[model samples]
Target: MTDETDVLEELASLPTLAHPTASPDGERIALYYDITGRNQLHVLDVESGSLTRWSDGEVPRAVKESPHWSADGERVYFHKDDDGDEQHDLHSITADGETEAVVTLDGQTTLFDVGDDGDTLAIGSTAAGQQNLYVHRRSTGETERITDHERAAHSGVLPPACDRVAYASNERDDSGNQDTYFVGVDGTDQRRLDVGEPGAETVPVDWGPDGRRLLLSDTSTGLNRCGVYDTTHDEVRWLGDGDSQERPVAFTPDGDRVLAVRTRAAADASVVYDLETGERRELGVPEGVSPFVRFGNPVLDDRRVLVLHTTPTRRLELLCYDLETDEYETLIEAEYGDLDPDRFRDAEFFTVESDGVAETPARAIDLSPATELDIECLLYDSGERPSPLIVNPHGGPPVQEKRSFDLYTQFLLTRGYSVLQMNYRGSAGRGRAFREELYGDWGGAEQADVARTAEHVIETRDWIDEDRIGVYGGSYGGYSAYWQLVQYPDLYDAGIAFVGVSDLADMYENTMPHFKTGLMERYLGTPDENPERYDARSPVTHAENLDAPLLIVHGVNDRRVPVSQARIMRDRLTELGYQPGEDGDFEYHELGAEGHGSSDIDQKKRTFRLLGEFLDRRLGRPVAASGRGDKQ
Candidate 1:
């Protein structure tokens, strides 16, 4: 008999499998796993519970993803960087364990779709400076460019008919707007589908079974809306208009109905929608315990819809919900048992008064133990009162914080701490106007919103130790943490920035070749037009205002926000008479083999452990290294 401790240890050591793709016949599934620091593709027999690895034993240099099954289900195609240039090439491997390269390109290539005939493959390549769609004939080894554009083309789809390909391109409008278009296999009959407004971005999500209609998820109104466009008539019609987002997952095999995923007003649960009767249903393993129920572009057979569902206590398994019987059957289950479900939360939106007259609808997650609240405070207390509070500003000043299962938040909560995830004015999901609010004012108004959110938590929540408050974030979030040290010197007791950009000028000059063009214009303003904005927002210029103890973590291979950003900030802080690892000062850690974010499990674990220790040291709490592990 196995011991209880041994069982628990075995469960903890279980590995996770991700990116599941079903074969054309829906009898087999292919997935990737990082069992021991190497990614390997595995194929599982649906009926036999037998598995086989396709990648032999040697790990690919870069990550392997986007597994696409061929028409016959005998071969699987994927993209990986065999060389060190960061460009991915298309490769195909058969179920019998034979591997071969399908096509090679000069620049990065993403596998879009394999044609229904298995003779043609659609791919996106950046061979001509900008990303465009291409059709490569496996027989001739000749490539044909489909879309010619300056911006980029994304979300490419090829119908089962195999005559034409549909994709979204930002060609017509130069304002970073995208629209759906289609082209023939021979590069003839290139025409843009009328997807309503030009300012709105439309992506072709899926093709109907008959290949006569296309389902599109449009973001024209700043919210996701579904529309069906008839290819023959070139007309579009919306399914519904609500302040929510809708995604078309799959079309019924008969092409009579569409399966869609819908998010409610506050963006909590993802529900399913029926196109024919306008009926909505929530799919899950019952409802009480927050089962992780997600639709993965629904796998439709002739008889049923195969929906993927799981939870924190359930492994990724497929359930076949019959159309007639409405009964469900488990089709496939991961070899591992009991997985963590991706947490989903509703956005609590409220207007916060800023600059006296300006009121912005600020969104945030409470994470407070007490729900009964009549006052507005940044800190709160429960039975275990007076715990340390960490104000976490999300990266992508343009990206808003959403309610999802986050490992970081769970880890902090387990260590007797409360985390406040704030979605400032510049965050996405609210609308275009809110997202553009940070265009020219990076550290000015946006920074003010961050301060206001923290203040709100402190004043209304009485259980928080206000003096022990800490700030932490990465990327743009990291910039916000550093700005907090300068804009409001006494706001946080300590600040921890991970792979953050401290100098705007250095970020503009040092980012990857592809990101430099937009980074210079979006956050730091144009180098020629607004040099003052660049100088003003640079955190290095205001480094002297940093009085709190600080810790900086960066990955040497980080191309988004390069390592130099952290090195420059550390040097300046040292110049200001601060010593490394000294008490009440600053510390730096440069992860050797990591990128913008630490992907290595050991590195992530160590980083979080160090972060918790630093926070405990500053907040006067007990420092314990043991806690909940990685979420993924």
Candidate 2:
């Protein structure tokens, strides 16, 4: 206990690594790390323990993100935006750490896809609020705007043999309708490949390692179906669809089969799909695993794939799955840094009475009014005789709470607080219909499920106190916290909303163009068609119902749910006589040099410590004094 660091300290000191890209030769792995308080590109000698910084300290404040290695292993490409400005430009750093601009256009240009030969780069060229695909060549130092799509256009992969790039665009109709398109590498032969149905999204996954096919995942049939686009016939063939969502992990080197991840209910399974007979063979997942595929990446050799596996008894570990013998080997250590894996608890996935899945280390309780549908709820043990409980509502309506490591949940769990995560209606991995439950009724059905989840946790858990229950979430989850606290005040003790939406109407009108059109317009319909519906679901309309302590934190540069929402929320709270600060029920913070969420470690540490302090004081429970395990 004396040797263990607090949750805030751990979260602050630990480095977050992402976007791991390997060189074409598979000798080096380029990863973006936030170890220096900001994201920086670092190259790892995969065979050795040597780590080298790929970029010099020229762009200190610029978040060095999206590190992709050149096929020749000579250069690394990345994008950087200064001072949180959206004016991103593409830059390439050589093997010797010398960086130079690659594509400097009028508007922001981001490197989307780089070809195998390392000469051609697919760039998302944005100007005057519209983005289009551009092909940039290093050999000729020439750039060509390919699609000329008036709407947003994003590309994925370019086959080594074919002179065409796979992309998705909504050029004609911008009702958030996105479908796959292929255009020539030199701005010719533009053609639409798939006529996906409305509300269907077809995204280009990646180019085949053998250059024989292009992998794609289509949601036209309502479930993400993994398929391949044959370069020989230029025809698309589907492997599987419906029921569980199938995501293509990687294609075999010979192009004879593909590794696909199938999510069935709350659990995940790895399968190998045959390209010839279309036969699928289910592979063995890790032993004692709760069956959530945390990490899976195909090694360049196609002999073994790296996967992150978690079990109810252990934390996550990178395992190498060999395709030939079907054996697994530990690739990375089970422990992170010097942190002990035994001290952590893995979430247990459960099916509620209404078929909803809830995940937590806590005991799950079923809550359903006599007339209402039952909802799943997790109850974590606080270890104390009586303890404070925090209800966690996840973002993404269709994102399920699975058996995996949740950093925030772990942080709160170690602080002697029980956290409840709800897998409400519309959460994915179940099926098409189950995930589509909140299509036009986002605030209606999901809110009921969240309320039921919280109520069940407090009413059934013996250690949880009803008056100390709180809700916290970010983005979509942020909306859940704000909406739940405002509409059903008596049900929650306090609320902390991070980059959340307070008013659906305001969100629909003020969000960024693509998000406003893509997500909100499709999720809740346009305000022009459903003004009353938007108002009915808005938490601001029922401001009089808010009586709990509320804290709102938002990044000022957030374009998804603008900072204005937080300002408006604070205005409403002040108008309702809730003062700001230590004694008040309302508090707000707007962080600069940040986006919706951030990769800045200092800011994250500051925000997390503030959260702990607020919860400890509000719930009347100081977490620093608690060291006992709260596993249920």
Candidate 3:
């Protein structure tokens, strides 16, 4: 038996919930939980508040996704990938738990929207590395390819009572410009709508119940602005102020109003938008819960919306809202019964002070330069003063570290480490220019912002131990972890790079075919177009400057950031005379059966254990007699 005393083990053992959707009748919910070693379908009885396991017998753990109910309550729909290879197939489980295959394909296939009649599905796939949209007929098993664009198209949706499909696609233009395109069911007469001003790119969200008007989100400005595109007039009517993000949750049954989630800074509120009047009203937040709302979707009962209520101190739970009364009721159906919610504390956000300095020490947070842009930093202070500091940066430079429950933050906090999550220049939610700041300049400005953030805390706060600072991240963050060690090695004692990119040139050439379509071209531009920038930004380029110990982790099947990233870094460090192991300056670990850091309970638990061990051995150890902050 495992040692139950380990907080990380406990955190790992806790089951997580995802892809939740309420049944059409509002009487039940079909969601999947990853408790059976693999994700499986589960149903909840809304009336009796009882939960039932739908996919219990499957062994060897098949990862499932897109759990939703059919037009009628008798069937639940979902898709499963084969052993983390990206090959997906859609499956349906009847109310009696009888399973049937909807569509089985050899490549990446996702079931986006299921029609009210439960006979049609909107699917987007990269079957042969040609990302395109397809409309599927359930009864006849017929598939019609819609957009034959060479580039990638995504977010396909089918509105009710219509023979047309709407999706977002980038034809040839780079810079991540995805225009909303509509095509007929038979794959003809495709036309792009004039969504907004030339700068913003619009993506299809949903259609009004009548399918006459399409709901879209213009994300060209970084923050999303909700809009309604009237098919009759071929015009766009903006809904929310683009400053605060307001995304479509679901349209009311009557279709005259859209239930939208409006978020400004950290706080979020649900609002109802009247299409005809063009007015909006904010919904009340539940008492004792943080204003950070992760609303999933409104149930069949148009009067209520499903909200994911999570805090630093508690595990996530599903909550229902009464739009009329503004009351929130918790559903006890989630599988978080055995998990202790009190182990975590809600994280606090603060603005750090960035003052001037010519220079102090080389390779350290010597300057404390000012943040050219307004950014927010989230701190999970261990509650005790003078604790170890972990500067954990998030991935997807476009993704923001919002106020939500994170097990890793809680685990680190519980183990006497203070974590600082920085929303640097490249992070989203601050608008377009802020997010695109690192566009052409990939590894430069963000590095300075991160350095300043840490230095700012060290200067302003007395509780953070300046000598015991470390950094860790995965994906782009993994790249950052290595980058920080080599660029500013004097400031960090240790670092962990998990499935991160170290070479921009290699990623452009080696990443999966779908990623090469526009994602890479959008940010880094082609290495062919900008070889100097790619060479300059790569962490591997500056590997010889390392001053601190580093831990590198990767998955063998991570096609996104291939294992070669870790291998390259390892080879360079070895060439510099660094050994690998507990005593070496560099340590490496790879999960053989995992792909791109799968959220399998065991894989995550292993990662957390490995991370805790590394940090504890390095950061938890006492300083040397002359202590220069080396991992030894």
Candidate 4:
């Protein structure tokens, strides 16, 4: 039997490295490492395998974003936010640890691309009510706004010349459809590329090694397709069949091939596409292992690339891959102190069929039972028979559950709890139609698919305890927890929602402007435009129907979903005679210094403990009282 405390501590204490970028000469790498349990900028000498901390605790900010190397590779550019406020400010630090702020704009400012000349930076800021493009010159300390739009616009790669930029914008009449556009640095000659289908999203990926052709990633046809737009020819040459979701990682050093990852059912296969002969070569990665691509650059030396390798039973490890040899060496090994990797459970991927039929108070998505929708799920079953199950819906309608290590899931398994992660109808990684299916039917078909699939698992698998099932999630998943409890109250014994949306209409009003136009409006339109749908879908609207125990956790400084979501749920439950505190079933926790989620290690430990304690109390399976006194 596993010691619950030992499992939770080691898993929670697991160190993490993220946002890695290779230096220009490929001798060093810059990334954020949580070695001290607080994420900070660190530089790793590739040859010596020595790590050096660059950023001091001068400002005491969270460095959660990616770091980029300047053209000359003298300094690394990164973004930091106050606590978890999510208002990112750009900063640069030299190898010698000389740090300085590059640009501090209002609202959330993202450093998109550092130009080839190393002086100009392409950025997107929400300061203007919505996300817009900006060009900042590092030498002069001057900033120029390139585009003023009501919707969100994000920049792609900045070419060597830094004269023109490519970006994706949803400013079209149909806000759901996004297209790639090119504009000069002076904000002139702004023209749409006419690259994708009518409603598909075409986003710029990278410039070819020569900077003459732009690599474009298209999701307009459900599966991802690639296109090379030649500036001189003024034409796009499309690549790949519309089979699987293929994403362009980078161009080969010689510009003869494109490194792309084809994703099918959440599994990725890295392949190189020959531009001249249309030949495809697989990278021959081990089965069930996926390469983690950094936001911008993943390439290291001329033929080497950096990838974060992860498997279901393994934690994420940074690795350097040689394309020519198809071999990789672990740069930073994932450490799980005092824990055995063999104790970790592997995920069992399966699918459940649910008809696209749904019934809602305001709307019905489909009535035909003939149209069955497939919902994919990943289950990590505990060895114990009749295991208490936690149905965990992933956070995004756009983010699906991947075959990767999850400490929380592992912790739960050690406590004899089976975890079920679902990709209900409208989740990403399955293609565009699978994603868009949840649009306009937020709590409708998507919710149905999740509940039905959970039910299917409970019925088919005798190992899952139907009576002790719980629903848990963060963000959209958090919203699903509330919706599931209220909609199918008898199905769940308890539910936990983290930074989740409670009232759809209120979320639309209170969230960031970019979320309103780019995310919410794209799904349910404006609350004013579809008030009935919004009212019907919002969980707070159905708070009276909540019958099971609920634990609501939200970051007070959350800008994406807003803390008001948790407040609204708590207020409604209070009004419905559900008192909160240690004495009540409806519990609420407001993280003071956090935004969407927490970056503090102690806070994470506290959260896990709280969650475990709640599950123990609600499920009537309290931890065995060891010498540690009732196993806190």
Candidate 5:
């Protein structure tokens, strides 16, 4: 008999690594480490090898995240939830380990910046159901609202100076598009920085050392690009100055140049741009990995740029880019080397005939070695016939699927299942035309693209069992899974959805107030503008068409998608005669304390175990004993 205790023990033994944050002075680094099942912040002195724990004697309900050092480096500020409600509050810990609450608002508080003098804190709060900027004075305990705009404000630090703040707000035009704005410490002299026009939104990613030059990431009309705006001259210069999408990672400490990550389909490379000469140099790294390699954000010192890079064989390792030599050096390697590049299979990219003009490009990574593929297949039989196949459609139906390293993908591969991840049309990384393919045709084009990708995989790969193929995803991906089971009842044999939206109308109405207005109108047409489109695409309207076995997982406190979505679907499935724990028809599980994403390790382990069991049962694979309690 399989022991449940053994499963729990195995789960407790998994290794976890948190992103490391460097102090302002760059002399100390603070990071959250999961030591034997608990996540805690640990500070290490660069010169002395001294380590200290900053978490004050409490088992936090959520993991400590976004740790930033105060201007003076005397204190460290972090976000955590102690009350189990999942609302994060900002807290500060002194160098000597004395901790105190900086601000405790009703909703989640994101600390944007601390003044250079360490007296004023710039924070973004969602207390009013939309994000608004605020400044909290430590000396007087006075909290003043900075931006009172009708739309949401995302706060960031201005370049060269820590006293001034830069944020993006949709105040000027209520069309619900954001524009970059700069404000002083006293919240006066707020002016719109002309990074882009009214409809073209600008996102401030990093500031130059002198505060006179700013690096901005712009995503207008579905294409991503990066540029540098000179605050003094009010001149904007595009990095790379071409058609490809780009992102600025950080500015050099001298403010003379900016480091950026440039990405295209199937290829990602990093480069540095010089402000004075308008010259760009490539920081050569391996291909096939994301360009956002840095742990916290890319940090610059006099000699080297500290970044985190991960190859197919590597998890995430810290590397140093030396400016003088234009070379790279490995600093820290990820512990999981056993499951490196050679162990897993690689995918191939091809052009698919779509919409009469080859409008979309397609890529497929084979989970196993095979030539002949199965079409309209729930499962395909290689030498390992009957082994389960999990088809994961990525979130952001507008986002393209890529050959990248994902933790969940690795975990499933270890469990002896072939996984197929598809990047359909409307996904980013592709050019503007391909990404906007689903703009007015979200459900129609995106859904058809996914179905086509599945058919292509089954027809080309002999390893996948056409009958045992299961669909799984979260958020938009989850919505796709639900839609697939309902719209094409005979396509997938089983389905798993996490925080999926059953009704587009309910999702738009109940989502966090800030994202509700703009995002809803963009993806799904407004309730009044395109009523037919909304009614036709929404999964809730086609619930009766569901024919496959389904398992729905949701966090009860999920404010983004809300638990009610899963609840409504569960109730409908039950009403349709699909019952839980009865030969895999329908089941729903809600984590009492989780929100949009699962943070607790045990809950994550549970989610994986349940998913594995469901797929195993439906696909006729031998279910391995649960790896829950097998800790060392």
Candidate 6:
């Protein structure tokens, strides 16, 4: 039998590699690696296949964003914050391990694009209160504000000429709707593109080789579509058939075709479309693995491109694909230590009837316009008959739960528990109507979908222990755990909410300006405009209904969801006569020196161990031999 230390070490010690970017010459790749517990910069040589750590020493902070290579490939630029506060400051490191702070700004700062000549950097920052675009000159050491918008705006892409930039902003109309705009580096000749409709999302993806044509992705027609906007003609040409969801990823090396990813049933495939002939050809990528095209230019050459591939059981691995040979070479493999890769479990896909379509929708506040709702879910079995189950609802009420790998899910499986993940309404990968169903309904239909799906899986699968079911998640998922336990008190035996939102109105007030305007207003309107809806949807309003054992974990420095969210829930539970201690059912764990999530390996291991201990004590751990299947 494996001890707790061995299980935690094996499950939580897997190293990760992310944000792979090819150098300008396409000879080297820069990526962020967490092999030293926290993320750091690493350079991978394409020809030699040797990886070298560029950042020196171990620091408390890790690289927060993708590293950008200089035009000459001598210096790589990245950003880091103070213990995940998200107030990123730009830094540049040379090949010899010399590092210097390039641009230091207040609030959150993002390095959007670096000029081809290595003279300018287009960035978006919240230093002036709201996110705005700016241009930093390398030679003169000067930074100029390019836009003075009242709302948040992000720099999208800077053309090769380095004279202007394309950005996305919601300053024109509703905060929920975003449109693309072009502005000169000197803050002149600013105009919006007539590419997207009102109340639709449009953003620039990449620039063509000629610098006159800009690639765009929009949701004007209720599904993602790629288009090319010509600055000279002031016209747009759409690509692909208007049936399935597709988004432009990058322009091909020669600019003769557009490389895009098409989504179907929550899985993605890479396809290239000929600009002149309108012909589409799908790349022969491996089946069941999602290819992640890095932002900006990912096309290394005419015959080769770089993509990060992932699956349900494996972590992200960088790959170099050859278009001519239809073969891929793994550049960086995810380190799994001495454990067998086959020990991890794969997901089984299932489609459950939406709770709204059922005879009686449980806890649904109002009926949405969606008539037929088919909720997609992934179930990871622990190989034990009658296993304890964890129902994990993903965050980003708008984000979809793809067949991707998750360390937390794998950790749960290692502890003799099955995992059920649902892509509830408002999840992406589905069409517009499905995502819009949860727009104004927050904890209503989506919560109902989760409950119904969990109930359905419990009823159909004899291997799942209905009495040992738990609901857990982080971010919006954390909110779902709170909402699920309160709304459907009898459904869950235990619950864990990590950095979750308990009060909707409070979250709107305390969150960043971009989150408030871009997400909250778009989802449920403003607190003043719809105060009752905010109160009605919040979990704190119904905290009295919570009867299950609940564990609340949050980071003190979390700016996204805020640690106050957990504090309020703990206070409420206390007011309702519940105590928090080793002898108590309600518990709260606050992590210091961390933000929305932790990057330190020790913290991750501690949290995993705590969760396992909590659940084991609450819902007795399954015996290795007969298992919980014999209970029923």
Top candidate by lDDT: 6
Better of 3 and 5 by lDDT: 3
> What lDDT score is found at residue 409 in candidate 5?
64
**How do all the candidates rank in terms of TM-score, highest first?**
6, 4, 3, 2, 5, 1
Backbone clashes per model, in order?
19, 2, 3, 1, 39, 0
Which model, 1 or 5, shows the larger TM-score?
Answer: 5
Between prediction 1 and prediction 6, the one with superior TM-score is 6
How large an RMSD does model 3 have? 3.7
Give the higher-TM-score candidate: 1 or 2.
2
Tens digits of per-residue lDDT for model 4, 134-178: 999988999889887788988556877899888999767776788
In candidate 6 the C-alpha lDDT for residue 306 amounts to 84
Q: What does candidate 1's lDDT look like per residue over 72-141, in tens digits?
A: 8888887756332346678888866788887788766877777778888888887776678899887788
* Candidate 2: pairs in clash: 295-308, 398-428
TM-score of each: 0.80, 0.86, 0.91, 0.95, 0.86, 0.95
The TM-score of predicted model 2 comes to: 0.86
For candidate 2, write residues 92-139 as lDDT tens digits: 787687888887877567677778777888878765466788888889
lDDT of prediction 2? 0.68
Q: Candidate 6, residues 299-392: lDDT per residue as tens digits?
A: 6787788876778877778888887787889888878887777988999998988755323333424445444578999999998666889999
Ordered from best to worst lDDT, the candidate numbers read 6, 4, 3, 2, 5, 1
